[model samples]
Target: MPRVVKPKDVRRAEVLDRALALFLERGYENVSLNDLLAVSGTSKGAFYHYFPSKEALVVALAQRSAGEAFEVLRPVFDQPGKNALERLNAGLAASYQVKLGMGVPEPIAAMRSLLMPENQALFRKIVTIWEDLFRPVLTEVITQGVREGVFDTFDPEGVGDMIQGFAASIQDYLVRMFDAADAKSRRKTIDDCVKRLKLYGIATDRILGLPDGATVVLERKQVEAMMTLFMPSRPAGSLP
Candidate 1:
């Protein structure tokens, strides 16, 4: 019997899936193209055929991950049964659940990597891609809230931008706190973020579905290990 050959798209997807797992396990910079090919069980030619460089691979992975997140939340915005705020809250809860289910540190590792000055260009490109992809969805949700009188903001587009900026700031703050091994500061920052969102007309109850004064808790040792893996230069200390 002749050996079966995979379709081009299937082969490309398999390579990407394997590469993503490798990148998530070992930080992107720590994994070379040869390492990716080795883990993916793909020839150098096939790897190059799909991704010309490691940077391209990273971009592809980011796009796919971001796209999946969007898909997960998109329906909440489109579905008609729920009120605007409820939909928004459901979408956020679902997103958080997805992140927790992955049990991977890709988000933290990728964010830390992008914060480095050397990755500034790639970071900017990714920011642009995410802004383009998410802005419309967020804007639509905000617009729905405004129409339903749930949000007082007159300018949905501007409010959407502010919301995105706020979320980004919180994420950056968490990354910094994780680096510093300051879990107390991390929890405080999360509370502060929730309070600020309330000021923006977001209901306190829908503040990412987090309980009062409580934030998503991760295993301290696991988080510390991930921080060390992604940011080795930071001084180690016990998590607060």
Candidate 2:
């Protein structure tokens, strides 16, 4: 057989997923280009064709994470027969359900790996992916809120930036939560995370001129579900 040619998208996704699985398990910095190529079964030139550099490859993974999150949020934001306030609240809950420590094993592993201190630069790149993918759509929703007289912002873009900045500032706490050494410390960090989320929601309401409880940026039960991921794994052969 003349060499079988996979569709470009299929081949690229195959290489990407396989290589990313390796990176997640091995840690990104521990895996070199040759290692990625070996695990992915692609030649150097072929890997270069799909990803210009190692950084680009990991950036794509970050984009995939953000893309998954937005996919969950976008429909809620765009739901028919829903006003901006309703849609915004729904989107916020939906995102809280999926992102954070949402129990999807791959993303949890990927996040843990990326948030490693050695991967700080890569984590920063991922943050940009999230911001780029999140901001414009939110600005549109903010515009909708303004048009509906549901919000009191003259500049939807500025308010949107403020919301994103507030959310980003809380990210350091998340890193600390992941870094917590013991179950008690992790539990405390989780509480701090929840309080920060509540504060951010309140800030959003104030910025948009809605009542303090108007925006549902997070919910108690949903966060309770997400926090289970941070619980230290039980020792082997211990209580279930």
lDDT of each: 0.61, 0.75
Q: Whole-model lDDT, candidate 2? A: 0.75
**How well is each residue in 53-104 modelled by candidate 2, as lDDT tens digits?**
9988988878876887788778888999988888877777766556664666
Query: How would you encode candidate 1's per-residue C-alpha lDDT over 66-177 as one tens digit per residue?
Result: 7776777688667788776676666655654453334456665555655655455555555666667778877787778778777666667776676556544444544555
Q: What does the lDDT come to for candidate 1?
A: 0.61
Q: Which segments of model 2 are wrong by more than 4 Å? A: 100-102, 219-221, 232-240
Best candidate (score: TM-score) = 2
Error of 1 at 129 (Å): 4.0
The 10 consecutive residues of candidate 2 with the worst lDDT sum are: 231-240
lDDT of candidate 1 at residue 187, scale 0 to 100: 49
